[model samples]
Target: MMTFIESVQQALQYDFILKALLVGSLIAVSASVLGLFLVLKKYSMIGDGLAHVSFATVAIALWMSASPLLVSIPIVILASFFILKLSEKASMHGDAAISLVSSFSIAMAVLIASMARGFNVDLMSYLFGSILVISNFDVVISAVLSLVVIVTVIFFYHDLFAVTYDEEYAQAVGMNTKFYNYLLAVLTSITIALGIRIVGTMLISSLIVFPTVTALQVSRGFRTTILIATLISVICVILGVLFSFAYNLPTGAVIVLMNAIAFGLAFLAKLLRR
Candidate 1:
């Protein structure tokens, strides 16, 4: 058997692996940052909901022979808006709105898949991830979208934090709560889309939720939590990718499992500290 170092070198020789690493790292940072706010505001399920919407959009795009990324992004963003609208006007709040949309979207995706190709390997890739099939175009799209997420979060950090912690207080203080809420939804949609390639529709939300909660176990301040979560996410992505490559395992599942391990460690550490 090849040594660990040799195995890593062999994996790095593949272009797809390089793209997966770069894109996965970017997605990790974006997801972890956005997740902090989502977790704080009890909107973590939005990522999962949007991921399912993207699933349907991807199926539709495939049925029409269109680019899945291009087709899914806008549709997913619109779905995010719809969820927000439902929450605001229909008395469906948080997880209820998410579950309603997600359940419907996933059902639509299943129907489309059945009518089109009956759940082929390509569709499996989107559902469970296919990092090794990542193309240059995928990398470029991931980079651009990830950059947008990072910059937007930084630009609106204060407003997002205020709204996340206390929406009514923020509104009372002249903050545009609605705008920021929509903004968060939009950014989250983009992040979820970017992550679909790396972690698949089924597991993308783990990237958004796990690291933040893990970091929260050990972090005391907001900025510190963000920093720690980002670091944890990046580390998990890198290590998980490497481990998956070395063992010929599924990248998304490995990354999520690593995140779970990190969470366990953090939880234990927190218990010890107390």
Candidate 2:
């Protein structure tokens, strides 16, 4: 139904769409792999909480006139540290603490954004995502960060796998699981910041959790799960981008929805087989 000239015009007018697709697919791939461990560890909600922290940091960055990345780095790093410390207290459940922090962070973001004028419009894009508005700088930063996330995950794969399979044994074997946990939190924070411009605070976590979750429901092996999740995420991103382009819809939301659909279909398939 589409002609070559129409396709070319669409591509030219939406160059940012290509940029968003590239960055999002890369993000989806890495996040899907990383998310397998997070889901296995029962810390999937941490990704959602970290996104809220990023929202608050973005507000602070606007207030201070500093680069959002620089400002978000310390804030999220500290938040991650505190989360780790709280998890150790033995009195508070990790999920409860994560929920409290996520709520508080989002409230603070709203209050801060309301207090500051002229940032609300720009802020909306970050909240809901403007994939078509991704900048050259954002593309470069995302590419480099994706590389870092991928390399770190690969280098630590064995240790992470051991820890996930059995934290008790990992501790008995002298693997400082505490350190790896903190490291993962830091990595997640960085990924959240890197993802804001592409998927925004609200929807970024779908990229992190959905693909891995879906893959986990189907694949028996961890490596296979990661590979399948990455593939699924790429397809979701591509479809989401095209759907957005045709419908003039929000790209991140469309992508996330596609992911949800994939999850539903996978779940249905599993149920039918059973």
Candidate 3:
């Protein structure tokens, strides 16, 4: 155990590990904050939806030798809007809309890879995540976007809460419910895209869902839930980074497993309190 702690300490001294930890912390906080609203609103899977869209966009960007962040963010944002429109206008369920878009996007991803033949290790890194090899450009992009998400959530907290908890009430009170819904989807899209580095598209939704749901297991009040979720997410990222380094495991998967363990413990604690 001491050797493990020493190795993690050694890993933290490196620049890349520090960058990964910084980016992971930012993403975790933003994801947890936004996720509380989304989970309450029953849109928890939107991250998964946007992750699928990002997969397609990343494939195209890699095939074109373009910046993945530049390409993925815009395309995923558009897909989020599309999902929102489908849910609102087409009389479709939100989950159904997400499923349709995500399924199509994943298909497009495979098709793009098949036709363009850009199935390299770089592509795999984006799919499964490789924070250890994340570039300086990716670090900058992730940091900026994660901060944008955190700031946006802070600025629009009440409006977002209104829309999430009771959209009809918000609309009846003369709030622009439509705009808030679109804004939520947009922020979620950005969060999902940014998470590609820390957790990968395949598992990024867990970053949002696990923390929020785990918080729900223990907290009854909305504010308390958010605080607990954010705490859980931040701790998970820190521990995940350290353990992944000490054991040479995949950081993304380890972080997810850490969240699962947190959720399990939260559930047990809830039972004990009963």
TM-scores of all candidate predictions against the true structure = 0.97, 0.93, 0.98
Candidate 2 has a TM-score of 0.93
Candidate number of the best lDDT: 1
lDDT of all predictions: 0.92, 0.83, 0.90
Off by over 4 Å in 1: none
Give me candidate 3's TM-score against the actual structure.
0.98
**Model 2, span 1-274: residue lDDT tens:** 4654465458647668678778887777778878888888898888888889989998989888877767886788788777778788846778887887889999999899889978888888889878777778778878888888889999999988988889999999899998888878877887778777767899888888999888877888989999999999999988887777777788888888999999999999989888
Off by over 4 Å in 2: 1-9, 12-14
Candidate 3 stretches with Cα past 4 Å from truth are none
> Per-residue lDDT of 1-274 in model 3, one digit per residue for the tens?
9999899889978999999898899989989999888888889989998999998999999999999989998899999999988998999999999999999999998888888774666778888887777789988988898898889888998889888888898999999998888888888888888888888889999999999999999988888899999999999998998899999899999999999999999999999999
Query: What's model 1's lDDT at 227?
Result: 98
Higher-lDDT candidate of 2 and 3: 3
How would the candidate models be sorted by lDDT, starting from the highest? 1, 3, 2
